[model samples]
Target: MSRYAETYASWRADPVGFWQQAAEQIDWFTPAKSVFNPASGVYGRWFDGATCNTCYNCVDRHVVAGNGDRLAVVYDSPVTGQVARYTFGELQDQVSALASVLRGLGVTKGDRVVIYMPMVPEAIFAMLACARLGAIHSVVFGGFAPQELATRIDDAAPKVVISASCGIEPGRVIAYKPLLDEAIDLSENKPDHCVILQRDTQLCDLTPVRDVDYAEAVETALARGEGTECVPVDATDPLYILYTSGTTGQPKGVVRDNGGHMVALKWTMEHHYDIKPGEVFWAASDVGWVVGHSWICYGPLLHGAATVVFEGKPVGTPDAGTFWRVIQDHGVAALFAAPTALRAIKKEDPKGTLIGEYDFSKFRTLFLAGERSDPATIEWAQEKLDRPVIDHWWQTETGWAMSGNPVGLGAFPVKLGSTGKPMPGYDIRVLDDAGNAVAPGTLGNIVCKLPLPPAGFPTLWNAPDRFISSYMAEYPGYYATSDAGIIDEDGYVFIMARTDDIINVAGHRLSTGAMEEVIGSHPDIAECAVVGKADALKGQMPLGLFVTNNGANRDESELERELVQLIRAKIGAVAAFKHAIEVKRLPKTRSGKVLRGTVQKIADGESFKMPAAIDDPAILDEISAALKAHNMIGEPV
Candidate 1:
């Protein structure tokens, strides 16, 4: 018999068995023969024999059963102040038509496509259609620059690229077609077919440059004879390629297969979220990164639930009240977004204070990820929103939710900082130097234990060695999450950042080592150190301290421009210099591990921690001198 574990006593008994049972929640097209595969290259498979089309379950199941005619998506646009709703059947038809359009563009099974659009209903439909047809879709965030978009296109090498005319918000209109054109121009691996969805223009005058109208394609598909059999995708078939923010070198290409992905995502929804049919589920991820791939697309869709895809920023024209208004207005049951957005809204709360005006009675669980949520942020949101803001701690590599405040199965007491207990069957542990389990209260590296869960990458799209080195090689047998964590005495897990060496810049994962390498590659530079500075907007931004060998020859302003251009050429515009200082000496220990925290402290105009390995304290003066020269000292955090 199944059981619930809302507290420690109930949850500590056994977790793997709970997860094993939860896998049965989704209506599998076929049964899985094996629960786990010990192999390293391929991601672990959940339902080995399962064969279900994700769209069929998300759409056809509910519609054919005649249980849903209610609003599926309540799209609230910030610019026009518009609210549009779509029925479950309407979404199903849209998905089917979109799938037909994709087929028409020669996107067969196993083909890769890029869907670069805003958080709109059509984008969701395109993603569902891809899943239905077994075509892997890589959705890049619309705000990403051309260089960043081009890098993703090069990595994925998609056959088709989809974009919209323009999207509106409080600040500005994101001209999608123009950006897409720029990205496509930069990329040698350009998609043969470019489909444009003209959203802002009622009568869109699409530049006649091999552009297929999105609505026309959908209309054509809607008129097509229904396909007899849905695409029979196996458990191991590659479903999508969700590229992480390339903070280190190139972005690590995390490929999710059909069976294990659906299994893990569906399992996450069932156990961690308790999503049910006919419920309105809304995850505010833009469907670009893993959060969107799993929750926004796979999870709700696989469960035959109505998912919401909103196309506006949280802080729209009216102020920061947009998110709360949408929640109350739509009766959204489940909500998810990054902590960055929450912090912004917290600072810029709408006029006439005390954020208790809206009714959040309908909204049950609130999910947060992308970056860690602080105690103040969580408390503020809960107080204002009047609901439990469940802080979920997982990454792109983990595939689905690993350590989170799971819904019902294990509703453990909310620890101030903990990301709650690991979802059932996650096989998680905090290990010490020797990879042995640490004491409950001791802080150590987090690792996924034996019989690996099926969420992490099954394999890199074309680079298998890259996949192996990224996850396995660093820690040997156990999968290294690169996150510092602690499994507290209370049995809850708390995660810190990626070993303190890396910075979570906005949504991008960046490494101090990688940034230093890029900066050091220049001939004029003697040595360079990159440190992460605390920023409310972009979780953290890289502040570079460069020691130029020929510092006397060039002006600081000229060098700054040169360094920025060099970084842009080397690491693309996304990782370009936020700020740089031409320093005389870098605060490094004799044993060499540049004291980034010390640099960060210096950046924040605070005291520093002297590493025992540092040979000379006098170098600090040089760093201070550099900061003064570059005007970085006394910078607001």
Candidate 2:
């Protein structure tokens, strides 16, 4: 039975009384009598006026309970096979020392600090250190090129920048000092100083005017006894700026508040993961993204759980088995990574030498996010890794794990392609375009009606108007997730795809993601992208483009006919493809996101606009070739 199953039974029976009890978990400056505002459609407010420092909630509170000596962080160094563990007490001290260094460089409350580093232990240290002194951190994803790096630096102007030697990325190690050197030469507002974390663990070779070694700086500051005074922060104070790849095709700075983010993530860790202190845990996404921030750094710390902030990709380095090795080599209790990582693993022969050696006895919970997990991948992982891949669904806007197949308490009968039932102390609904609840099994946008739980929110940093216009204006009076999903009879959520990812073929609506998955599942088709192409009679038709797993040259007519048949088999005649173009590769962003709109632009007989951020522009040619071969010839895939 789920820990909250009885409460869920009662809550489902009478929601009004259920939240009245749920609201008692936190410290509230002003008491909220109710959890819902039926009239406004907003339903969350916990401990109104409550003020708590996020880092404090993460570390100090745990220390006060005498678990200070317990593990707070586990560092699985790819360079060294050793697992570095830091107790809550030692982690707090390091965070304080780093916070002092940040303060010494003149970063104060409300000042922004841009952190571009690999998912190393220092990345978490820098983030919490900034939080300790009330400095908002804007972390750019580590995989970005120099130009995209500059854009983020421009967006979040910081007094001091923290960067690491990018030894972990593909090909050349992206020396941060060089990029910092170039970005500084270009920017009018260059960082006052640059603190370099030697990922190469080597001293800086390039010259930047005010460059300082990160480790030595912290050590020097600690010796001086001039540590940071952990400032008292307000609930509404800006905590950190996490950038999200919004539909606008540019990274939107999602400015999250300290208290609100803390409350939400902490609640999620406690209630969803059922996490306990001293347990070793790892959230596989890098600290550069929200997953790294909420789950890996702040949330775990806030809740007093030990966390692993790894620096390397699972597939890179000596072998793909690195992640499995880390899990068994270290007793990782809970592990979280994106389904993107898993899909890549799935594409690799499942019988690869990597899956057989690990001991999974220590793993209790595993989370898959970034994108929805294909159910096949979930079952395969369950059998291979010897644990359930709790296929989770959430976005950058939701803070942390909003919907998850809860492992410890709320395990339900696993539904193929379904994220679990709603979490404790929260309510979720699937709403139509009209904002009314949709019938169960009928697809609708996911909506979290207001009075939003402490962490549940709708905002784009400081831009309230943008938040209102984007989330609110879409469906009117509801926070539209923009993603298509359905609520099963058991209240489990099955996210289909992004809502706009639909196509009309002979007046029949079809989802490109579902259809693309069908194409990708084909034996020779290793990866695929399907999009709607404008047509006269049909209005729109499905056009597919793909990269073959075996990279075999095939008869164009034969391959095209085979794909059409595959779609017909999976989705019926109504959703069969108009044409398919087999390509060597599809255009993808650096983060492995397919540039779907770019493909649509090509299909529309228009010139595609490239985001200046993409690291490789050559891949666009392959899309063009596939499209041309399939007679999608106006432009590209």
Candidate 3:
């Protein structure tokens, strides 16, 4: 067997040993006596009998190992035009002081602390502080609608809420304090204490009874030389709760364990990204999302790498060159961003001219995730950047990458549309409707074999039954990913779409992702999203919504016909993808995922609630207008 195959075989032979060895990479207050216990359901209990402190592993260990002067975090904000750097010693000091402040407010082990803040350095400080005090934190994305924040608050019922005065977006300053107060008032469960970071004192309001100034608390604690000792907890202790969208459209609080998270993320840094100690690692995502929690916050820090906290949008925060500028200025080695961001850059600078203006010599690799990446975008990025542009796939339920091109483990030939082979720790397979394994090159459900890897979420907070019904009940002895995919003969898996996105047309299942890929590759198109619209003859037909390249002055009718013809030629005439509409833009989430479900609803003339996570709710109006112009629907009811 080859080296990669041999290693994988050894891991399969002894899964427990594989995890035990991986856990040794991090510091443990008490080593694990049992690697895993299968009696625990779903993901099982990993590293049972272990005791550790995540903050100490991330911060204190580096400082104590004589690497105190090494830079730990580099904060770059285009909105504020400020750059701040922190070393291990300084970060640890700040984190410790914040932990002390939380303790002063009567927060103890297992208490939930709600962190609703912007993508600022203090957000990291608050997260690490909670970890230090063994307090479980639920970080709601900043600028969420008051109702949405209230829903999360009611679910978590945190004792303390940490927030900032305002958050800076591309063209506006979003006042967060007012939103926080409104959410608190709307919530049925109220937090007893509120720690407000006075980011803009003029724009902030304080409640006399519950409010505490962050600067005052931290400064006082530091002046008194107050220090918080990292609290050691059991391996299965709840670390933090992250809310992810569920099938019912309500947020499901995914619970993660302390030991498993620390070990798994450290493994990801070296094994997945090939990042070494003190290397600059940047995942340009918000801290409110899982990508931020893993790569941006925990993964890089656990590996002793310098993590960049980017406080800017993908485009128009200055220009499309913002990312490249940060990379050049900070010597960023590995950068992770969504494909949508790349598409935006491609649209803004069609010739890849801005990349030439910046020095990207230090950059090694660019990783894309959060959505399915098109081959055209990958080809464009690779040709322009002259670096490996890898598409890795994972979800919020899984803390790190489940499948990717692990260059550190072994370099493999690039597959244009595939997310490479499954990572070492995960055992993946494709299954048919009846839970039987499917043949290669056949589209079916994606399922992970029993006993998911350590980083897989343990359970949903206060809703174990929902977790089982959602992921486990579908397939016996396997965790259904709720996504559809196909395994090629070479073992590379191509993710087609979500199971719900599979449209059955006259007894034949078709993937919207597959159709979108072909349509998006057209020369005039910048990006496109495909959804199944109801049809009388065919069960469902593919409805394509696309945007043209920025400044591409093309005849809409001519380009639409050409794209439809291209799709028919590439995917065969049975695709029946005749309907293609040109729109000014596509509606997307703040995290850069195209809101396909919403678009489909709008196209079908169905009533769809405007999602609070939408980056621009006004885009839905454009989608409605396009649908009306096409005579596809009467109006968006």
Give the number of the best model, judged by TM-score: 3
- The worst-scoring run of ten residues by lDDT in candidate 3 lies at 1-10
Tens-place lDDT digits, model 3, residues 562-607: 8889988988888888878889899998899888888888777788
The better candidate by lDDT, 2 or 3, is: 3
TM-scores of all models? 0.76, 0.88, 0.98
Clashing pairs in 1: 43-458, 247-509, 247-510
The local distance difference test score of model 2 is: 0.70
Q: Backbone clashes in each candidate structure, one number apiece?
A: 3, 11, 0
lDDT of 1 at 233: 79
lDDT of 2 by residue, 1-637 (tens): 6665674567567655655554454343344433444443222333334455667767766777898898888887665444577888887888888898888789898899988877677888888888888888988766555666676677778898888755455444555667666776777667888888875454466355677788888888778866766676666567888777543455677767765566567657766776776677788877766777778887777767788867666565446777787788768878888765765565554544577777878878778877656665676678777776687777777676556766656676778678777665446788876677888988777876554555555356656677777777766645677888788887788777777777777867677877876776666655677878887778777788776653355676687788889889888988857588767656764445677777877777777656543546787776776566556756322
| lDDT tens digits, residue span 294-407, model 1 | 777668767766677666665545777777777777777888887656655654652215356777777888888766555656766777676778887777776777777767
Q: Which residue pairs in model 3 clash with each other? A: none
TM-score of 1: 0.76
Candidate 1 positional error at 223, Å:
4.3
Query: All models: lDDT?
Result: 0.69, 0.70, 0.89
What's the CA error at residue 520 for candidate 3, in Å? 1.5
lDDT, candidate 1, equals: 0.69
